[model samples]
Target: MSQFALLGKRRFAPFFWTQALGAFNDNAFRNALVMLVAFQMGLDDHTVSLYTNLAPALFIIPFFLFSATAGQLAEKYEKSRIIRYVKLFEIGAMVLAAYGFYTHHTSLLLIVLFMMGMHSATFGPIKYAILPQALQQGELVGGNGLIETGTQLAMLIGMIVGSALMEIAGLGPLLAGAITIAVALVGYLSSRGIPEAPATAPDLKFNWNPISETARVLKLTGQDRPVFNAVLGISWFWFFGTVLIAQLPNYTRINLGGDGSVNILVLTLFSIGTGIGSLLCERMSGRRVEVGLVPLGAFGLTAFGVDLFFARPDAALIHGLNWLAFLHSAGGWRIVLDLTLIGVFAGFYVVPLFAFIQSRAPREQLSRVIAGNNILNALLICCAAGFGLGLGMLGLGVPEIFLATAVLNALVALYIFTLVPEFVMRFITWVLVNTLYRVRIEGTQHIPEDGPVLLVCNHVSFMDPLLLMANLRRPVRFVMYYKIFNTPLLSFVFRTAKAIPIAGHKEDPQVLHQAYDAIDAALAGGEAVCIFPEGGLTADGEIAPFRPGVEKILARRPVPVVPMALRGVWGSVWSRRDSGLGRARLPRRFRARVELVVDAAFGSEQVTAASLEARVRELRGDRA
Candidate 1:
């Protein structure tokens, strides 16, 4: 089913609107307050500046201080109930905000701002942790895409509405206050439809001390090296976005020589591009959480950020113009495309990381880990402010900062990818499998979610293991022939995936023993292991004789044995189908339709060399 089909379901639609409405109200209030302070208030420049700058700090402060407490609450109680309470708090906060707006009381409005911030901080854990429980693994990526798209679109609307409302005569405060209160109340009503998401760690003790608990939660977030790096990648995204979005106004005036309308235009393109990119993630990922998109996103962020600098080189030549006028000017299309594509890539970069976190993080503790991510994101936003400031102090222009940020992004992405090679490895495998062949998988549900399982398949080409690794949700450790395991470029991927290399007994008895030990250890430790019972790729577009090694392994440690067959890869470029006098060559079939058919699992005792081969042959029929 298309992910959009989720919108028609009771389980998803209500919760989605509640979250989106909450985002709209938050942005509307902030933008209204900013507009009021900037134009309506009869204050001097210094006071206006003081209040405007302090607003962001007040809003974000709760994320740093209360996120740990919030994570604990979500874990200790029901998530749906927490969300309702959060919505109630929003309504109360908006009431206070309404009164402040009517009274023109700046201090009261700031307090309401802090209250809204606290509400968001308190619900941060529920926002992410509830996803895994609410949707299936296959739907997780699409669900996240919709959330991202909604949030960005809501932000755009709220900003525009909030700022526009402040300019109206006589009834501006009444209109703003009424809209916020109504939205909050509606959000609470919407929360009513969000079915209960039971607590993940109900018996977990609450840590009242925010400082210690915050540290502990963050430590847990880093427990898995890959998860930690993914978290870092996400935080870095917020940092990069903070810098780019925060500087857009300055960049417009100083570099693009554009006015307020042009500023809105740039922001619109970025947000729209981000939404477009986010929506495309599910499709690009083949309806799975494809981390390969992460590398692709990082690459685009750097490439376009650098290009944006050159897109507007001579800002002095232009003067203040409206968005339309700016577009009509020379080189405008390039600038707009740069902004839009940058946002698109940003979407590509961020969506998968969230999916990865939700999918890969320990389920019971997912909320706490997300809370830790929120806390880190808050910190990164602060650092980005400092980074932009440092650049300004050096007398560099905003465009120069853009250039510097792009350069820094490249370095950071390289460092992160190096620390976690699985991301890059997956990218390569996904590219090869997704682009070079249209792989169709059947009986994926038959693959066990946990515990040990032995997968036996007929190998058709050198790319067999990679194809399996790329398509299967669960990671597999392949038992590969020794020489193929050492194949030059492919070896890096095998090593990173921790593929076990086995040699023939006559060639190397010690290697064979070690390979057996490795297979035994992997299964005993409760991991999926795939082995080609044929012991090698087909030499003449046929299944080689099934070796008895699988029987030996099953005898050593019995597990559910799954049988799979590959069809149509036999004539592919990766297969050595034509060989004569020790010479071999590949067919020219690229992007072929290859079918991966998996039969129901057989008991280890039920599986034998000959019987499994017969079943696999039947599954493949004449295709192989």
Candidate 2:
């Protein structure tokens, strides 16, 4: 379906607006509060900074205190009903905010900030979980992209409008109250239009206590490794983002030398870059949750962040320079571009990770897992605040902090990649596939999205595994021969990818046992393990006889077996059929259409070596 269909669908459009309006109103009221205290009442710089930082703390506190309860509500009750209640809460919060504005009661305004947080906290699980229920699998990326872009844009606009309105003589409170109430009313109307999302766990008992429910949700997420890892990745993105964005205000004042205009510029550049990247996800991903983009994004983030630090103005701070003059100054324009690109890459980094978690998570427990993720995010944001404060106390300047954050991002990316090599491996494969051949995957639905599964494919070329890895959304552990697994330069790649190397029984019994044990463990952990059932590469570009080793593995593990066929790999330079004398002798610039066809999955009881081979052979047809 087209991406626009999401807006036309009753299920997604209402929730999208409700979320966008909520984000707009949140930022609007917060910005209005900041402007009221800072400019209208002429608060000290220290007080302004404290209030700015405290706002995040107040907002995030609800996620920690109430996210688990919110997840349970989303799972145990119809989502539409819950949304109506949340919208009503938003309206009530706006009423409190209106009162706070009329009385000029800063404390009441702070309390209203917490109330807004509570409203958002309750909406958090439903926001993510409802997408998978309402939209088709193909529309998930687009739907998420729209929501992300809309929210970011709303934040930018809300900050601008709120600040502008507060500066007016008599329009401040009226504008704040009018906008907040109108948006809340519109959100409530949208909530009424949201289609019914049935409860995934209707019988689940409600837990009013936060601590125990938080622990329960976390434990449930631990049961799914991929989903859990994706959650970690998402939370890390927030950590990185909080740190980066927090530095922008100071970076503009001290480094860019453009007063308030610089703040707007930074926000505009970063938000626009992120929105562009978010929208591009639908196109770049080809309508699937392509995680390879995540690594690509990480690379760009580090590259741009480091460049931004170096690109900062060399001169000491100057006063009264507008954004245009600032840009015309030495090294100023480059810094702005670098920051914008960092945000762009960050968008690339985060959007796909969210989509991956949503798509891979269990339908019944998705909301609970999202709640766990919210708790983690809140914890990380707090950590980020503490880290930033510590750095400032230690006499680190804003520029140095930016540089340190960039370097720290590189280190964190390295650590995460080291822990899960599948990210790096998939990145390499994505690069190769996109650069070399245009790959078209058919029958992707035939592959199970969950549970243990064995994929049997024809062994065609050295790039076979890379091809399959790039196409499949899930991480797959491949079983390769010892020789190929230990190849000089490729050995590091294989090892990093966590591929299992097996030797023939006659060659090494110990290695064979280890390989089988690894496969069993991977399956028990609910991972996809792929094996070339033919055992060895084709000697003459033809399907080889099936080996009984696959049958042995199945006998032990008893997982579903999926037959996959590869086309157009036989003629590739990496193919076993290639008899080139040297690297220069290999075929150059050969254009071939590569296809990875996924056939229906078969149970272990129905899949013998012979039957599996026949199924693969049929799919392979006359092509190798």
Candidate 3:
């Protein structure tokens, strides 16, 4: 089903609108305040600068102070109720904002900004934590994509509408105020339709002190190294985004020679591009939480970012051109394409990380982990602000700042990928699989979401492990012959994936025994392991006779055994179709159609080498 189908379901639709509306109101109010302070109030340059600079800090402060507490609240109470209360708080804040707008009370409006920030901080944990409770495992990525798409568009629209409303003469503040309050009310109404989500940690003790709780929350977030790295990756995204967004207004004015309309045009293009990318993730990932896209996203961010700098290296000779005029100028469309792709890549980069965190973190601690993510995001955002300011102080123009950020993004991505080689490994696997074949997967639901399972499959091609890795939602450790495992160019991926390499007993008894031990240990620790009972790849696109190795492993560890088969890969590039010749042959067809069929798992006691091989052959049928 399309991810959009979630909009028709009671489980998702209400919350989606609620959150989207909340985002709309948040941006609307903030941009409206900016308009009031910067343009309408007639403040001096320094005072305007002071208010502009202070706004973001005022908004972010609550996250640092209340995120831990909010996390606990999300964990200890019913989520729907909390959301209702949050909306109510938003309503109250907007009411006060309406008063401030009418009276031209700058202090009161600033206080309202702080209140809005508090609203966001309180909502952050529940925002992510409730998704897992409400969405199925398969829907996680698509759901996240929709949420991201909604947020991006809503925020963009809110900014435009709010600023436009505030730009109106004599009635700007009143209109902005009314719209914000109405949106807040609508958000509350939509939230009322959200289904109940019971707390994951209802029995846990609550800690009220922010300092101690914040420390504890951070520590809890780091418990799972990969998840914590995902959090850091997310935070880095905020940092990168902050730098880009902070520079855009000036970049539009100075580099593109565009007026305010052009700035909005750039933002609209970016937001639309992000929404497109977000929606494409489900199709790209085949409804799985695929981290492989992260590396791809990182590469695009750097590539397009550098291209953006090179696309226009100097300020325009003309100033104050409208958006349409700017588009007609030299290199205009190129700039548009660069900004849009950056946003597209940003979507690709972030959606999977969020899904990974949701799928991998302990349910009880997920809320706290999200809260930790928020806190770090806020900190990185601040740092990004400073980084931009520092560059400006260094007399670097916006284009130069873009260039530096792109370089730094490359470095940061390299560092993260090095720390977690699995991301890179998966990227390689995903790329190879997607490039070589159009895979149709069946019966994946039979694969357990968690726990140890032994996967037995036909040994048809060298690309089998990677194909399976790309398709399966959960990670699988494959057992392969040492020679294949050590193959040049592919060894890095194998090692990073922790594939167990073995040799025949006659050739290397030590390696064989060690492989068995590793397999057993992995299964015992609740990991899935795949092994080809045929012992080696088939030489002639036929199933080789089953070997006894699988039986031996299962005797030692009586885990479930899932039989799997791959079709149409027998003549592919990595297969042994050219074993009789000197070199591998090119595929007769590019992107050859392939099928992966997984049967319901057999209980350990019910599986034998002969039976499992027969089942795999039956699954493969005459497809090869």
Candidate 4:
């Protein structure tokens, strides 16, 4: 089903709109404040700079002070109720905003900004934590995509509408404030329709001290390295985003030589492009949490970012041009494409990381993990801002900053990919599997979520292990002949996955004994291990006779044996066909349909070499 299908269900739709509306209001209010302080009020340069700097600071400081507490609250209370209360807080904040706007009270308005930030901090944990409760495991990537798409688009629209509304002749601030309140009210109403999301840690005691709790929350995030790294990756994305967003107004004015409309046009293109990429993730990723796409995103960010540098030079001049004039100017279309692709890649980069974190983090601590991510994200954003300031102080222009960021993006991505080759390995596997053939996995749920199991399957092709490793939800440690395990291209994958390499007793009694020992140890430790009972791939695309190795392994460890079969790989290019590689050549099939059928596990006492082969043959039937 399309991820959009979630919108039709009460489990998701209400919460989606509520979150979108809140993002919209936040951006709207901030941008309107910016417009009023910068362009409309005729403040001096220093004063304008002061408010511009203070606005973001005021908005983000609360996250540092409150996210730890908010994480605990989300864990201890019904999330939907917390959401309702946060919306109430937003309403109260908007009320204060209304009074400040009407009375032109700058202090009061800044206070409202701080309140709105507090409101966002309060919702941060609940917003992410509630998703796992509302969404199924398979739906997580799709759901996260939709949420991200909504947020970017909402931010774009809200900024435009809020600033435009506030610029009206008389009662401008009043109208903007009213709209903000109205949006907040509707958001609260939408949140009411959300189904209940019970707390994952209801009995947890709340800690009142922000200092110690914040430290504890951060420490909690580090408990899972992959998850914490995902958080860091996400924070890196925000760092890039913060820099680009902070630079946009100045970039549009000085570099692009465009007016306000062109600025909006740029923002719109980037936002919409990101939405498109976010929405496409499900299909491109084959409906899985594909971290492979993250590297693809990183590549795009650098490639297009560098292209943007060349597309609009520092020397270009088109002063005060409107959107139309800017588009008609030299290199205008290229600039637009660069910005759009940058956003698209940003979407690809961020959505998967979010889904991965959500799916992997422990349910009980998901909120606290998200809160830790927020705190780190806030810190990284500040660092990004500092970076831009340092560059500016060094006599760098905005475009130069883009170039520098792009170069840094490449270096950082390489560092990250090197640190975690699994991401790159998965990306490669996903691409090859997706491109080489259509693969369907049946009875995947038969694979236990945990514990040891001996997986017995018919060896059909050279790619059997790759197929099973790539597609199966659970990790499977395969026992294979050492020679096959050491195949040139597949060796890295095998070693990285830690596949157990064994040999025939006559050929290498030592290796065979070691393999048996390793298998026993793995099972004893509650790890899943798979073995091909056929001992080797089928030369003619038929199941090879079952070997005694399966019986021996079972006798030693006595674990559940899952019988599996691969169908429709007989004549494929990768499979051994005709007599020899240099003779009897024939046309190779492209993207042949392949099915992996898994049957219910045979209880330890029920499985034998003969029974597993017979069951697999039955499952394969005539397809073999």
Candidate 5:
């Protein structure tokens, strides 16, 4: 189903609106307060600047101080109930904000701002952690995409609404306060519709000390090296975004020479692009948590960021161009395109990382891991501010700063991809599989969400493993023939994916023994392993007799064995049928229709080589 279909389901829709409304109110309240202070209060420039500078710190401090505690709460209590309570807290905070607005008291409004920050900090863990429980494995990427799109659009709308409301004569603050209160109440009402998401770790001992819990949660986040790096990648995204967003206003005034409307125009373009890119993730990933999009996103970010610099490096020749005037000016649409594409790439970069963390992290500890992620995001946001400021102090122009950051993004992405090669490996697989074939998967539910399972399939073509890797929600360790494992460019992917290289006994006895050992270890450690029980690819479009290697591995490990088949891959470019008299035949079709049929797993002791071969052949059902 389309991800939009989720918006109609009771399981998802309420929670979606609930979070989106909260995001809207958060930005609305903050921006409204900024407008009141900067315009309505009649304060000196120094005082106004001080208050504005202090506001973000107040808001973010809660994440630093309370995130671990909030994580524990999410783990120990029901999420829906907590969300309701959070909404109630928001209503109360907004009431205080209304009073503060009426009296024009900056200090009181700042305190309310801090309360809202605490509100968000508390909600942070539940925001992501609840999705895993409420959503099916396939719905995960789509669900996250919706949340991202909602949040971005809500934030942008909230900023615009809040600022516009506060600009109204005489009753601006009152109107802003009223709208915030109403939104908070509506947010609370929405929360009531959210289905219960039971605590992941009930009856667990609670940790009350923020400092120690913070350290402990960080340690927990780092326990998985790849997950930790994924967290870091998420934080880097915030850093990049913070820098880009922080400079946007000045970039509008100085570089584009556009008025406030033009500023809004650019922001709108970026936000819309982000929403588009986010919504596209589910379709692009084929409903899987495909991290390959990360590399693609990173490349776009650097490419456009550099191009954004080149598109308009110097100041505008004329001043005070309205948004329309700016667009009608030379090179305007190029600038717009650059910003929009950057947002699109930003969406591509972030959505998968969120899904990856959600899918890969331990369920019981997922909340805490997300809390750790929030803390790092907060830290990186601060760093981005400093980074932009430092660059400005170093006398770099805004465009130069953008260029420098883009270059740094390339470096950081390279470092992260190198640290976890799985991301790049998956990217290559996703690209190849999606480009070459239209893949259809059946009975994915037959593949267990967790634990060890041995997957046995007919080897129809060289792309079998990559195809499976791209489609399966869970990661797989493929056992391929040693010769295929060592294929030059593909070898890096195999090694990074930790594929086991096996050979026929006559070809290499040691390699065969090592492959068996690796298979055993992987299964013992509760991982899925796929082996082509045909021992090699089919010479014709027919199943070969199953080898006993699978039985041998199961005899040692005795995991459940899932039978699978690849259909309509027989005549693909990489298949044996495409090799005509030692010359490669041109692919008969591009994006050929391919289906992966999976059957229920059988108990290890329930099957033999003959029975397994029959089941796979049956599943193949006349399709090669």
Candidate 6:
């Protein structure tokens, strides 16, 4: 479906505009206030720095203080109603901002900034949690992509428009105030059109006390390890972004030797790149929540960050050279390209992660989880500011700080990837599947969204597990033959992924027991564990006789058994039935189109070897 279809759907369109307009107004007013206090007032450097630092603090502090309560409110009342009220609050806030600007009251201006932040804080949970309610499971990636792209673009335009308006001789404050109120009113109108979204947790208890509610929210989020970890990953991205973008103004002036034009150039390049990458999420993800892009993003962030540092011009800043002149200078274009690509990679990395969290989080508590995310984002942004200040204090120039941040990003990314090898592993699998074939996954809804799941698929090739892992949003532990599990090079990936290596009883009784124990433990912990029932690759390119190992595992765990089949793999180079004699030959580029078909789950009594084999054959259809 086209991306705009999401807007026409009663579920998504209203919320999208409401959120987009909110973002636009937030940046517009904030930047306008910053310009008034910093440049127009002709404040000293120390005072300007103080207001600059306090602006973000005032904005973010509300998230930490009120997100818990906001989350509860979202879960208790209908989202449309709450959004309308928030827009009203925005109108009042903008009126106060206009007053502050007219009277030249810095204190009132800062208060309005705080109120703007508070408005955003209240809207935070609603912004993210509303998507899952509005979008079908298949549309989450596309929906998230559109939102991300729109948001970044809004931020870019808002800053530019706000700054431009603030510079107008007599019309600056009046225009900004008028624009802010208009946007707020439009957001309200858009929100009124939103269909009623019933509360997910109607009976959720209200906690008025921020301290206790914040603690409770954090504890609730901790219940889902993957969800909690995903939140951290998102928070970390904000940290990285805050540090990089905050230094751009100085970097442009000192290194690029461009005046105000460089600031616009940097913002334009970064925002455009991010918008492009965000839009690509739907296509790259195959309409699913493909987090493989996270690792890909990390790689690009580090690569371009390093290249940007090295790409800096050696000469000092020139007084009169414009942005065009700077670009025409030696090595200028490379710096621009590097910064733009870095932003592109960042977009690729973030969109999928957001979709993953939204799709996988429990429906009832999605708002609270997003609230937790907001808290962490606030904390990380604060830390980024401190880190940047410390670096400057330590005599690190802006360019040097950029270099340090890039190196640190690499280290942090490595640590996160090591902790969750699934990120890297999935990237590899996604690349192979996407490059070698067009993977069309069907019946994915049959797989349980939560709880212990045992997937049984025909092992057609060595890459079967990777293919399945890439397609499934939930992580799974694979049980593999000991020999294949221990293969050189691949073993590292398997081991890092913590896959279970099993051996036949006749070959190694100890290894067999260990494998079963691991599988049982994983299932007990509510993880998906996949096994090849045949216990070996298909020998003749046809469905092999059913093996009893799957039955035995189900007998012990009694979890829901999901039967899946991979078609079109038999013709791939890794297939056991490859026509080429001893060694298999590679297939033509993009010649293979693979499909993973998931069938309904079966109970223990309903899933013997015979019954399960019939189910698999039916799913495989004539291809089997």
Instruction: Pull out the clashing pairs in model 5.
Output: 292-427, 568-624
lDDT against the true structure, per candidate, is 0.90, 0.84, 0.93, 0.87, 0.94, 0.85
lDDT of 1 by residue, 1-624 (tens): 898999888888989999999999999999999988888888999999999999999999999999999999988899999999999999999999999988889999999999988988998889989988899888998999999999999988899888888889788888899999999999999999998899899999999999999999999999999999999999999999999998899888977889989988998999999999999999888777889899999999999999999988556467788899899988889999999999999999999999999998988889999999999999999999899988989988888889999999999999999999999988888887887888887877788877899998899888899888887777899999999999999999999999999999899999999999999999999999999999788878888789999999999999999899889988776786644224344336778899988888889989899999898898888997
Error at 253, model 1, angstroms = 1.8
lDDT of 6: 0.85
lDDT of 2 by residue, 1-624 (tens): 667678888888888898988888999998998888777766799988888778878998999899999999999999999999999999999998888887788899999999999998999999999999998777888888888888889889888888878888877877787788888899899889999999999999898889999999889877877677778888888888888888888877777777788788889998888888888888877777877788888888888877877787343467667788888888877877887887788778888888888887888888999999999999998998888889999988787777787788888888777766666766776677777667778887877767789999999887777778777766688899989998886676678668899998999999999999999999998889999988888767888889998988888999988899998777676775555333431554354577889998888999888988888889988866
- List of clashing residue pairs for candidate 2: none
Cα displacement (Å) at residue 323, model 4:
2.2
Candidate 3 residues lying further than 4 Å off, grouped into runs, are: 581-584
Please, what are the lDDT tens digits per residue for candidate 4 over residues 1-624?
899999998999999999999999999999888878887777899999998899999999999999999999999989999999999999999999988888878888899999998998989988888988999766877898999999999999999998998889887898999999999999999999999999899999899999999999999999988788888889999898888887888899998999999999999988988898898888777666778788889999999888878887585465889999999998899999999999999989999888888877988999999999999999998899999999989998888999999999999888878877767777777777777889877886787767898888888777778887777765578888899889998787788777999998899999999999999999999989989888887876778789988888889889988888888877765677644455442456668799999898888888778888889999998886
The residue-by-residue lDDT of candidate 6 on 306-350, one tens digit each, is: 888888834355655678888898888898898889888988888
**What is the clash count for each candidate, in the order shown?**
0, 0, 0, 0, 2, 0
Using Cα atoms with residue i matched to residue i, what is each candidate's TM-score against the true structure?
0.97, 0.88, 0.98, 0.95, 0.98, 0.91
State the weakest 10-residue window (summed lDDT) of model 3: 580-589
TM-score of 4: 0.95
lDDT (10s digit) by residue, model 3, range 166-195: 989999999999999999999999999999
- Which 10 consecutive residues of model 4 have the lowest summed lDDT? 578-587
Q: Write the per-residue lDDT of candidate 5 for residues 112-192, one digit (tens) a residue.
A: 999999999999999999999999999999999999999999999999999999999999999999999999999999999
Error of 4 at 181 (Å): 1.1
lDDT of 3: 0.93
Rank by TM-score, highest first: 5, 3, 1, 4, 6, 2
- The residue pairs found clashing in candidate 1 are none
